[model samples]
Target chain A: MDWIAADWGTTHLRLWEIDADGGVSKRLDSDQGMGVLDPSDYEPTLLGLLRNRLPEGRATRILACGMVGARQGWIEAPYSAVPIAPLAATRAVKAPTRDPRLDVHVLPGLSQAEPADVMRGEEMRIAGVFASEPGFDGVICLPGLHTIWVQVSAGEVVSFRTCMTGELLGMLSERSVLRLSVGSTGWDANAFAEGLDRGLSRPEALSSSLFTLRAESLLRDLGPEASRARLTGLLIGTELASVRPYWLGQDVRVVGEPDMAEAYSRALESQGVAPKILDSEEMTLAGFRAAHEALAAHAH
Target chain B: MDWIAADWGTTHLRLWEIDADGGVSKRLDSDQGMGVLDPSDYEPTLLGLLRNRLPEGRATRILACGMVGARQGWIEAPYSAVPIAPLAATRAVKAPTRDPRLDVHVLPGLSQAEPADVMRGEEMRIAGVFASEPGFDGVICLPGLHTIWVQVSAGEVVSFRTCMTGELLGMLSERSVLRLSVGSTGWDANAFAEGLDRGLSRPEALSSSLFTLRAESLLRDLGPEASRARLTGLLIGTELASVRPYWLGQDVRVVGEPDMAEAYSRALESQGVAPKILDSEEMTLAGFRAAHEALAAHAH
Candidate 1:
């Protein structure tokens, strides 16, 4: 292996082995995400996973992103200010490792000052997109636990906003009163469409509309499948309503898991906007490759 | 004691011993609420709490309200359709108790057909308000875990809506990413006011505004007290904006605990509406008294 790429998020850690010709040779994933590890545990955890793959006599470069760089993770890589390039590889912070064969670099996340927004792992996806299409300038939406909407201009992230839609949905479905009505599995397309329309038109009624789901379940026997889909639709619709300006007349691309990206596409399509969906894993890998190239160029 | 007035909700069970003259003789409370008890456990729990208070050999009439009448409670009293009197005592359901001395009559809750709304405990507060002022006509707001906005006209519940504002706030503050920013203690009125304005003006930005709280805490050191208060304000403000039609040009009364009622009052006052705050416990007792009177009238 020539190098390694890692995405260490709150709940999961994914790693890819890069070959000499710059292709992914092998991929491994684990549940040892940054959320479960202390600052001092990151090196030991990484070593445990990569001990077999590390070069025998030389330090192997490992480029890492996401919450692994958060204050509570391995080490705090300070967030870079916005209107800056997404792939600032030269600015990556080096983490101290006792093992001679492990060399780790944690990339800095992006932050906006005025509205106070930040992005960690999602920035790499943006970098991946920019790396492939050098002059690409538009809005990019990365939907996940913390959905981010970013505007790219002249190879820089001009500004961005984040919505807690995914987290809210999970919490509401699993912990709130709606838990009884919204189950973990299933989907109902018509119900989703209905909820999406209600959310887009009356965003102010978000809280009340949520209660209706529980009431409908009790009074009308609304099934869990329909309730869950409706909740998903409502949250995404509300998010789309909030970020209309970001995707209204601009070319928009959604980079996320296929299912989630499809939901975003359906919501955007409802508002007369067509968004192209891109694979998030591919983007993250492309981003890591771009960072590697930059690191090698700077070494000269 | 002429009768027993009970308010058995999801989290707590409160009982008031009523004398022949229709006055409260003594009050007792416990944590054995409906959420924790089973169908068979209800009789035992109630008997254990009121064993000493029960009359020697006579059947003691018990008027119970709240979640104790829910489907999951000791026995389902079933919801009474609305556009009808809030205190429909004649429709109360009788529960089968093993102890001959315990005559429990659970009061039915109010439900609306069109909007698909249901309220178990708040109906008592509405009935209590009407018990004092028979000709009362206006909107009554009960802010709690499930904030309810009820419309009353000519002694009948005209219509109503429920908002999960308090539950959403609790889940977000304790379970979501915002948990790091929002603490369980303290208050900041200024930050709350700022959040209120934002929520009222652009409620579509609800999801995004929540993310900003975490960002502000990370970047600018926003205090927990301020974050909590701001979250409270934003939710209440959004609720007020959504239920404007109910309180816009109508007399409004807020029946709740002092602190929560005051927050609702402040939010309403911001929109040029002055709402009268009533003690929830007092209203609940009054509601039971009204139900007792109707039960006596029907028996005679």
Candidate 2:
């Protein structure tokens, strides 16, 4: 292996060793995410994870993305303002390391000022999507903890907005009053469809409808599966109501894990739109490769 | 003291000892709310709090309202459907207690089937407001962890809706991503007003606007106090937008704790709706008194 690609997020760190032939030779995963380590500990944590994977030669170059580039991360790769390419080689920042046999660069995130939003690791993943399908226009929906809806044109991220639907759902299900009514696993298609219609037509009643899940459970014995599914549908439905401009009568692509992509696909389909779902991991690796190649081309 | 008035809810237990002349002789509070107790523990918990306050008599009558009547409570008091008077003495359930000295009556909560909503302690508090002003024909806004808007006519609750604004704000401020940007105490009138306008005008953009708070804090150095105030404005603003039908062209009365009522007052005032702020504790006590008097009248 001549180099490495890393996705260092808040909760998890994943690394892929890239051979000279542009192929991943090995992969490593760890719990040593940016959130857990102090500033000074970043270098040691990375070195520990890269110990046996290092090539027996000069310092090995590691291209990294995500929270590792945050202000609180190893080294602050200041956010690259939007209306620009997702991954810019000039924007990547160098991480300070005491070890002589290691070299690392953390990619910058993307930020928008008007609507006021910032994205870290997702930028690279979006860049990967662009790498695979160059000149792609229209909307790309990336679902996760903070689901992002990006408007792309001419292979550039024009504008984007993020919804805290996933995070809010997790909080409501685990910490809020609704936790008792909703369970962890279940799928009720009927209830989900009902919630979707309610949320889309009456976004204003979102707050009141949330409590209805619990009330119905107590009064009418609404099943746990239905409550859980309805909660998901309601949130996604409200999100769709807001981002109508992005998905309505537009060519849409959802890039995410199978489950999340399927969820977004289902929501979009409900709104009379069919979105092409793409594998997120492949797009992510392609994004890393794009950035790595951009740096290599710059070096050449 | 002649008798006791208690407001027991999910997480709190409050009691007021009433003299023969209808004056509060003493006040007591405990964390032993319905949530922390099993059915068998309710009597012992109540006895522990009423240890020294019990008046010497054949049996002390305790008029209680709230979740002490919930299914998981001491004994299910059963909910009285809405489009009815706030407190129905006929629906009050007698709790089975081992202590002969304690005669406890737990008032039923109010429930609505259509929109699927319920209110426990707030019902008694509203009843108290109705007791003082017997013909309140407009909207009664009770702000708390879960704010309730009750449409009243002829001293009866016609319909109601509950918004999880306060609880959502709490979760976001203390547990969500915005926690880092918002503070516990701060008042930015300008920020709050801006947030209100933003929320009311484009409630669909609420989720995106929340992330903007954090982004602005990081990118533009938005202060903690301003962020907190903006967050409050956004939630209350969204709530006002949804409950516009309740307060659009009607006289409004806000019944809640001082701080929460004040917050609601400021939000309402921004919308050009000046609401009359009433003391929640007083209303709650008055409601209990009304129920007690009604029970007495029934006996006669």
Candidate 3:
């Protein structure tokens, strides 16, 4: 029994075909991102991509994740309340028939809490990571466009908080007036660390601190690297203020690319808490595999 | 001799027909904004707009202020260093035009310490505000897109600092990730004050605190009004950090809108300081007049 996993995100579609043991055998990606596709069109897109990878007359159980199960996705999956981690056993949605020998299941992401944040794609990876490890109880942070902090207890996503830290950094650096100050290049790590620390220390002044990026550039003749760091710190500082409580009693595990984790790590460390780093892709695949096995078990 | 005064900015051309006694009889404005006009083309645009505004066939000494003297304006006026305010005696660049009918002099905006931070339009206003009240040696604050803090001494802009407070607020509220959490309409003033105080208190952490806006919204159910306040404080707090040095041992004057002044006033008040509020328009107009006199005297 081979397994197929798809992380259909807003801007990119990533699918991997794996063995029953969650070993990656083949992978394919498409520009037909979730952001580009209509809710009604998700079925054909997923089916077409999965069936393309798996030959006709081969009945393979496929698990799909991400915002694809959103209100506008292939099928609407209601939210799971806080402290109730998204379950491994998701209801199979009725997907369109594009191939004869395919059984598709679109895994629903969890919507927990008001101002109402949701997660689909990453929740799968979170669950999978928890399954692979023992005594995994507490917060797992997945950093991206919308960074998520999952409160896991007994392998469930009981409660989670979403922070759009990356998106804010991008907009401020690339589009806003601060764009002129950051210069053209990768961020300066020192400035980034300092900024992150500054921001976390002073959570209330978050808004005004952003302006100081350009001001510092003009007045102090600070380099682009420092300005970039200032911005990162400003946004992260605000994030710390809100999530400080979550980090107080729980063990924080951070899973993401190294560059991002660098800042979050420093932010947490400054507060006297050290985060456990995990391989981003490995956890993603593990989560995908866990979901596939759960679906298979339910069918029997 | 009738004196001509102009407020030539990045976007619009505003001209005043002033009697020798410094009374304005005619006010004319046009769509010729400094932002869109090229430096070489600025002279032509000014001449074109001034066609009917001036006395027919009479040589009028025209004095202009603002961005008309930036690198892209009618004349390239170099910036004066910080610790020195934009003065009536500040350098005036020659507008490139063959028509002797227009004795045009464009006042230069000051930029100190670097080539990146320069303000062309309001320098004269800062000068005028200081000159009008002699012995007003202190920190004068002019808040806007780039809030200017000028150290005025003997009626001159001695030194200044530029803060990107307003611009950052607009960028974050409109473009940043915080946009998701902040509800734009009907801000909470109390929340703003609270944010301002929190920001100023943790001035060093100004850089990192911005993310709290989104985090509180997601993790702690922080509302838009509170988020808005948090954003404001973040920027304000950073500004306070940079401006605090100049703020001490000086009588302060603020030249801006009342509400913004109130915010500043409260921030200062909390620190046991009170600021004098001046009319922004009056200062600008008076500054323009003073610049005109200086230019006329130089010709004499």
TM-score of every model versus the real structure: 0.97, 0.98, 0.75
Q: Write the per-residue lDDT of candidate 1 for residues A175-250, one digit (tens) a residue.
A: 8989989989888999999899989898888999999999999999999999999999988888888888899988
In candidate 2 the C-alpha lDDT for residue A119 amounts to 94
Expressed as tens digits, the lDDT of each residue in B38-125 for candidate 1 is 9999899888988777887889999998999999998899899999988889989999898989999999998888899999978889
The local lDDT score (0 to 100) that residue A219 gets in candidate 3 is 59
Model 2: per-residue Cα lDDT over B1-300, one tens digit each: 878999898899999999999999999999898888999998888889888667565688899888899888888888889899998898888899776788889889899998888888899888888888888789999999899999999878999999888889999999998998999996898998888888888886777778889889999999999999999988888888888998888899999888779988898987788899999989999999999999878779
Worst 10 residues of 3 chain B by lDDT: B203-212
Question: Higher DockQ: candidate 1 or 3?
Answer: 1
Tens digits of per-residue lDDT, candidate 2, A1-300, equal 878899999889999998998898989999998879899988888878877667665888899999999888898999989899998877788888877778899899999988888999998778988888898988899998888999999988999998888888899989998998998997888998888888899887777788888899988899889999899888888888888898999899899878768878998998889899989888899999999989989888
Q: Candidate 1: misplaced stretches above 4 Å? A: none
Cα displacement (angstroms), candidate 2, residue A77, comes to 0.6
Provide the lowest-lDDT 10-residue window in model 2 chain B: B50-59
For residues B1-300, write the lDDT of model 3, one tens digit per residue. Answer: 397778888668888878978888778888788767776676677667667665668667777887787655677766676656466353776666667677777777776542235577777668667557867777888887678777777655666667767766787789765787887865676777777776666654332356556555755678887787667755675677657766765688888866677667666766777888888767877887777767667768
What TM-score does model 3 score on chain A? 0.91
